[model samples]
Target: MRYVHLYFTCIKRSMISRLEYKKDTVVALFSFFFSNLCSLAAVYFILQAIPALAGYTLAEVGFFYGFSMLPISLDHLFSDEFWLVAYRRVKDGDMDMHFLRPVPVIFQIFAETFQPEGFGEMILGVALIAVCAGQLTVSLTVGALVVLCVGAVFGAVIITSLKVAIAALAFIFKRSGPLLQIIYNFSNYAKYPLAIYPFFIRTLLIFVLPFGLFISLPVDTLLTGAHDPWLLSLAIIGAAAVFFALALWIWTRCERRYESTGS
Candidate 1:
């Protein structure tokens, strides 16, 4: 409990510090919100033409798109640093400072960076969910709701683990930043109905990257009465475990090779 309080205090301090740069922060916040608004507009236009794709209505598609924003919001809230900071720390040899702290190094690193833009997105996503939910008229059992939440949580974990795994490559390679951009492009697959995708692409997403399973299938089961959500959620749990385990093992191995600038 004490550690939890300290963790939050650190985050609060970080937020306060960010507010000190009010002008720059406001610019960044507006830029991010506008970019996402553009994405939402694109989805609306695309669905306007097709009306529905692969048994999903526009509202259902919106729910999938909207539901996905929840995890993306959560990801930005907690693990945005994991996407960019790991490489910066490794390259700058500043990671040692984190190691010297009593808390877990990753925990300290994550706590220090807060994305207020993500909080803004979360508020917007909740409103979108409310609108989509009414249009979808989905029945929700207590058990199914639990599974949906678990899937969302585990889905976020898988994405974070994947980011860490990719970022850890910086320790061995000269610079992995370029490759990270390419990997980020894959996130587009999450913004649409996976059903409309080709079989091979769908297979790759499910077996290789697993992003499709993260947002699409679980939510589809909820609003559309698809089936086997419990089993699917368990599969997500398994996939998240595998992804994180591999990432942890790799990160541990790479830590030994870290060379600090400061003696």
Candidate 2:
């Protein structure tokens, strides 16, 4: 427990150090916030003219955008390393130091480059949530809040694991960024309500890819009482398990591909 706290403390300190050293940190952070706001604004403006996106209300669409973004933003903040894991580790051979570390290579990578600028997006998400709370009427029950928290954490884990698994494949293939980017693009579909999608489309998002569960569907359930909360929780746990196993398997298989210069 102490180590866990220290780990996060280190991450916070690292972020503070970077912000202090880089004069443009604040600018970068605000830029991120405005960029996200711009995206949300475009959605809001489009929805203002249109009655509904499929079956989702304007407020619900707002909630969906905010909620879906929460997971991706958090993932970007922490797992940014995964996106560069292959390119940096392999091409530059910088992974040598990681193998010498006491902690896991992945943890070390994540800890080394913790970007808190993502906090800006997170704050925007919170503000969006507040707006959605006001716009969309729902019973703010203790049970529902607990469910949402669980779902969010699970969503983060699943997204992280998906990234890890995909990045781990870079061990076998040097240039994996384009492939990862494509996967990220596909995951963006969850930024809106999946309910309006056809049966096959919904099934593909919910089961095959599972990004739809991250925000749209779960938050939709919270807003409209459309689906079982327990199902979201279960899906998060299940997806995390499956993806984690796959990542571990790939990492182990590719460990042999690792060649350190220190030897």
Candidate 3:
């Protein structure tokens, strides 16, 4: 419970701090919301002409799009600061303060820089998930529902772990702004069905990039009907756990090696 308490306290303070810059906050929110609109609208228009992609209806495709994005949106809400860390904090020596804090370094980093504008993605993603889910042919069974709820958490963890590993790279290189953007932009593939891609791309999404775990696998189970569908959820949870350990190991190693710029 102490962790929960710490999270709420940090987030509350961060929210208040951000609210002081109302114009920047409001403008960023609007910009991100419109960006999401453009992506969704692009997919909408494409599906209208193609009729179906990889054997799924527009509704199923929508579910895939939003389900994949939902966890990512949540990750951005909490860990957007990791981008700042990658871009400037380590290089400028601001991360020195994070090490001095009593809280876990990661928790302190995330809690100190909450960006509420990230919720624009969450809002649209959830609305799309809800409306598209209703149009799915398979109803949500109790077990499937539990898998999705649990899997969503693992999904968020996977994204956070990816950023953590990437940002931790800043500890070594001091700055790699473009690398972070490259990795993040690769997630655009997750917005579509992984199966629609070629074999090599499919492998990357499932194993290397693993964005398919966030959306396609679970939705595939729902569409195709699995006797032991929970296994897929277990796989996601297990993969996330493994990746998290790896990310933390990288962060710890780099933390030891970090040399503050002292500027």
The TM-score leader among the candidates is 3
Q: TM-score of the candidate numbered 3?
A: 0.91
Residues 105-145 of candidate 1: C-alpha lDDT, one tens digit per residue = 66776787878788888888778878988876667887568
Q: After superposition, how far is residue 189 of candidate 3 from its true place, in Å?
A: 1.2
Tens-digit per-residue lDDT, 10-88, candidate 2: 6887777786767587678778878887887898888889888887788777877777767777777888777777556
Indicate the TM-score of model 1.
Answer: 0.88
How high is the CA lDDT of each candidate model?
A: 0.76, 0.74, 0.81
Pairs clashing in candidate 2?
Answer: none
Question: How many residue pairs clash per model?
Answer: 0, 0, 0
Off by over 4 Å in 1: 261-263
lDDT of 3 by residue, 151-231 (tens): 678888988898999999998899966798888787778777667789998888878878776667777667666435677
* Model 2: per-residue Cα lDDT at residue 84: 78
User: Which candidate would rank higher by lDDT, 1 or 3?
Assistant: 3
Model 3 lDDT on a 0 to 1 scale: 0.81
